[model samples]
Target: MTNPFTRRPGGTPGAHLPLALCAAAMAVLALAAATGLAVDGRTVLGEPVWLKPFKFALSFALYAGTLSWMIGQARRWRRTLWWLGTVAAAGFVLPEISAITFQAGRGVRSHFNFETGLDSTVFAVMGGAAYLGWLMTFAMGVFLLSQKRTLERPMAWAVPLGIAVSLAGMSVGYLMTAPTPEQAQALDAGLKLATIGAHSVGAPDAGAGMPLTGWKTGAGDLRVGHFVGLHALQALPLVAVGLRLLARRVTVLRDLTVRTALVVVVAIGYGGLTWLLVWQAQRSQPLTSPDATTLTAAATLLGAVALAAAGVLLAASRRVPARTPVAATR
Candidate 1:
């Protein structure tokens, strides 16, 4: 057999080379984008022109790095399937980043920009690329379901659940693509449409947004939920690792069932939080300005998760073996 991959010690798979290289490339792109932000001084949509590129580069770099790490943990994976996923993810993602950066250099929006024929083409291509990226991510999530059980119960629960929520988060972007009432009315009036979608609801785009993220501070912004969802890929896994580590000193965490139950509860709560954010955004409410009803719902979610976790810990304590007596005090 060809040993092209330099294997890691202790039965783990080596890192996926292509994806690792892609992560490095994205990191370099992010650095360049950051420099552009520092010097460009140009504004697009009430923010710096380079901001989107910088943010996107950083996100893609993190995503690629995470995929690489997960790939490292995979067992008995076929080289062909691995290469296929790597090629597809890198191919779609790199071009998308390039187009975003290229558009930023032109001082215009990469998404929803149809002001010109070329801009429309760019948006169309980027849209297609976005769908493909989501598909590849979904495939990876589904792939994890069939992997060997070498990981601990907590981590084992985290991987699939995390990906499931991430996929839902990616889907949230679809809400941004549907034509808003403004576009609908414009179409009804036979007016020319320069743009077809928007990120803000109940507020005009490029208005009164938060710094850096540009999420609307006074109105609904779907990007908030979208951001939360994508980060779940990292967030839940970190949670699992943290619990696993705490098992060393924490009595409740020492039980596999307890750790797994905690991960599940956390995952459910995290997913519910994403839903709440999206629901809030849809109601044209800012995340920082939730109404009493939203607050009540939020409290309920917290209470429910906490109650379930308490129940799990209580049950686990009963099953945990007690410490042995110290030789009856001699």
Candidate 2:
């Protein structure tokens, strides 16, 4: 009997196992949150302790599901790639979730905490696992790019573009780990800060936040870009599929050229938005606070997208053959 998850052409059932496990983990976290079973500690933002686990669980579910589906779509090395990818993902993700959940249960901080030797070791291990996971993800991206012939035109473009954008977003996390100017000044004053990493700029992490997202409402929060950037892996493919479906309905846009061009436009727009978010965070401005520069940038981005889309449409129209007149068909 063949493995259900190893279906040669489009085997995605195997990926579903991990995704379901992640979903179940999230459900447990949610139940813990609702029942107030574990409310001993709070995050830097003063949210419930279980919030971090819940967030990670949800993110892992999406990540696993997306990559598994992509790998399933491939015709080569289906089983080998699936197992390798799953291992890499599990290696990093499990350690992270475990560390966070364990620390939360102990009512202690998990990140940027080096008070105890054990805590330091855990943090170091998690960091190492994270780097390994990134390397594996990069390898997977390269593999997908090389398998262009086996993928749909839209997916062929989406996979690489999505990975690139997501990596850019992940890089923003480094900024949090680095010492901010304020922190450096404090260090100069002989003050010792608890943790070197922080998510907010120009304001304390304890500042006001949105209801569910916990994004800083009073200052720049780098996590916004980080969140949007990583989700592009899912967003771009969904956009590509939507475009393909639309092309089927519109005869004039049925060509692969038109579909690819539209997908490119969407990718560019998505990347631009991700950059805009990073820029906004760097400026220490709240997402809701748009100055003149922000307005100008937004307008410029919109204009560029419109022009690109129009150009693609015009080029596609030129390529379409003119209908020959039928001679007097009574």
Residue 108 miss distance in model 1 (angstroms):
0.5
Best by lDDT: 1
Say which candidate scores most in TM-score.
1
Cα lDDT tens digits for candidate 2, 195-234: 6667888887878888767788899989889889888888
Stretches of candidate 1 exceeding 4 Å from the true structure: 1-5, 323-330
Q: Candidates' TM-scores?
A: 0.94, 0.86
**lDDT tens string, model 1, 1-330?**
774454778766777777788889989998999999899999987889998998888888878877777766777554643764586566677878988998998999998888999999988878888888888877777676556366666777888888889888889988998888989899789888888888888887877888778889989999999999988888899998998777777766777767788999999999999999999999999887999999999999999999999999888788777642211110
lDDT of each: 0.82, 0.73
Candidate 1 is scored at a TM of 0.94
- Lowest summed lDDT window (length 10), candidate 2: 321-330
Model 2 lDDT, residue 34, Cα: 44
